[model samples]
Target: MTNDDSKVGDIPGKRSLRPLGGVLAAMAVSLTGTRISVVALPWFVLVTTGSATQTGLVAFCEMAPYVVVKAFTGPLVDRIGPRAVSWTTDLASATAAAAVPLLHALDLLSLPLLLVLVALIGAARGPGDLAKEVIVPEAAERGRVPLERAMGLSGVIERLASTIGLAIGGSLVALLGPLTALAVNAGCFALGSVIIKLALPRSMGHTAEEASSPARKTEPGYWRQFGEGFTFLRGEPLLLTVIVMVGITNLLDAAITSVLVPVWARQSGNGATAIGLMGSVMGAAGVGGSLIAAVVAQRLRRRLVVLTGFLLAGAPRFLILSFDAPLGVVLAVFAVSGFGAGFVNPVLGAVFVERIPRPMLGRVNALGDSLSWAGIPLGGLIAGAAVTAVGLAPVLLACGIAYFLTTNLAGLRREWQEMERTGGQSVPEPSSKDDASRGNANLAT
Candidate 1:
């Protein structure tokens, strides 16, 4: 192996792993809170109003703000520093979430007010989440963690968080009611903000580009920074292709999670508890897959890992659901599907980290994530309507086939091939002057 390869292998020890530990802890706390709110908020809306449409509309309000704000805030994150953005916005989310239950108790809550509060929470969450994503590569580089390993670790954290959070959320809602769950969520977010603000080291505050840039003393205008991210993505076909693939899959996945699952549960004669259990099973499977990736991804080719994952993940759940399988069988199918999905994010994360320069990381990551997630609300809407019109089994089968074809066939494109071809070599760290110039360019339009 080359010296660079050796360096890659040795990365976990070069910088403090403490920062990664701190960041992941914060992420777990924040995500757990969010998951709890997901269950609690919808339950609150549905039980009180007795309207499924209203529940759907409330969800739409929350996600719309998330997609819109994240699309525009990438550059700001790059310019201002992710650390500041993460902590402050988390504070905002905590406040918004806390208000929902507190106002309800005070008899001051209205539907419109609740919708607006959830929207505010979504907006704050978008930037806060993006900031954390942008910081991952830098944190890895600083700690000498291999990019793939770091991203894999991130995926593991997310899966583990979701599993534990959803399980807890279900129990909380069942025992204490949704409002109490919301209150718990608020506390978690507040605590997460505190941990991130106080525990992380000063050196972890800035990107590598910022540390090396001499011109960093002068703050550029916002539009320029935004344009830079757009221009870079526009010029990179490989990046564009991956973004498109991710977006399509995200839309399909959203449909499965939000719409198809509930319909399937009802049709199969299982109640809401069974539906919740399906999620728990999938999440548990995902945690295992993510752990495997973190430990062994270096030995796998990125393209093959992604393609195989798509093949398994996209096909089985839909096929099983189409048969109106028993609840136990459905859970098993979804568990495998979750395993496949787990392989996806870490590889994709590593790819983005490797290709993008450090300075543009925040904007580009944010833009891509927002774009990919933008279709989630639409997915839920379309899936619900389609299931109602066409019946559950047919829609499930059709969507499953479409998802499988889209994800697997997209890999055949030439651009995807180019993106997957890594040379297994790491470039040397840039000198200070070069780093400064690169940083400036990365932030420029």
Candidate 2:
């Protein structure tokens, strides 16, 4: 649906959700499509190739370009504006996604060709996803919505999309097969592109576009813009610490979802059904937790909520599986982890939004998020090798221990003190003077 509100200022003492809802519509669909791909792609490789190493290799091909391209595309998003970047990239992703099954139908698909297409999809998706995130603050502002509430709502949307996507993915893969699921994924990407291009007001994302028009010809170049984002990220110890810690966790998480769990499903003879069930249970619980956090997390102590969430979310599933726990216990651990994981991103999002100003959101977000996600590409590959070399239990144990140290032990550092103090705040728009001073600081540093 189209957004009815698009002005810069919020109505006094009144909240509007139309703008945020409009943005979330496209975002939610695209995210769901990604989750579905997470299911369909791996299974496709596993069954067609019957090789876990190849599965991990395919994942690495997709994510390596995804991380690198996204890191560099942030400046482009700021220069061209999120809406344009989002729609264009989504369209590109749709085309790439559709090509896969089409080629396979003609018996033209080969491993190298498939990897090439997957890489293209990942490259397009990086800019697409970053653009979507850049729009959140603008959407929140235009609707006059509270930043924390809006961010929390975004977290809820992600969880719900993930939940439904996994459920649908499992059923589709089990019944209709991965090709059918791949076709549906193509449709989602196309639909998300249309929604963003047509449903949002022309006035949306005007800030970024205006900042980079021909009249501002002397404005900082792309590399300079990227450098500023990097410098700012370097200066913020708390943000750096958080990114490093989360990067480790993201790596572990990627290994689990992409390699470990899929292998576990196959080895146990539970197959896709078990994989679907475990993911769906965790995702469903995550939705409930995200909904609760959306309402009350902004009011709680940030440090406690975040650490508790990590503690609950991290390590348990790995440990549980390592012990060869019963089905019910495994599911229970997944559920608890999902619930705790729900509180994490909302708190992190709020802290992120509170710290960065409007002007810096595009570049800084690109840099910071890319850095945190840097290890993800390697996760699947490493896990596959480890599983092959040392066996599953040992690999799982090492990852669990590493996750514990990265998240829990690292939290004791002084940088995390900032999380407690800045839990529920929103940043004001940066003025011209503020922007100038920041620009000078970037140059000086």
Instruction: Write down the lDDT of every candidate, Cα atoms only.
Output: 0.80, 0.80
Predicted candidate 2 versus true structure: per-residue lDDT over 1-445, tens digit per residue: 6344344232332445555787789889988888888889999889889998898788778888898899998888877678889889999988998998899999998999999989999999998998888788767766656566677778888888888887778779999999888888888899999998876655555544345556346657889878878888878888888899999899999999878998887876768777777988888888787888878875788888988999899999899888887788899999999999988888888777666655567788888888999888778879999999999999999999998888887788888888764323453433442354346544533
lDDT score for residue 299 of model 1: 74
Candidate 1 per-residue lDDT over residues 237-331, each given as its tens digit: 87788888778877888888888888777767797878878888888888888888877776788789988888878878888989977777888
Which residue ranges in model 1 land beyond 4 Å of their true spot?
Answer: 1-14, 205-214, 421-423, 426-445
Model 1 lDDT, full chain set = 0.80
User: Where in model 2 is the C-alpha error above 4 Å?
Assistant: 1-15, 43-55, 208-215, 262-272, 387-391, 421-445
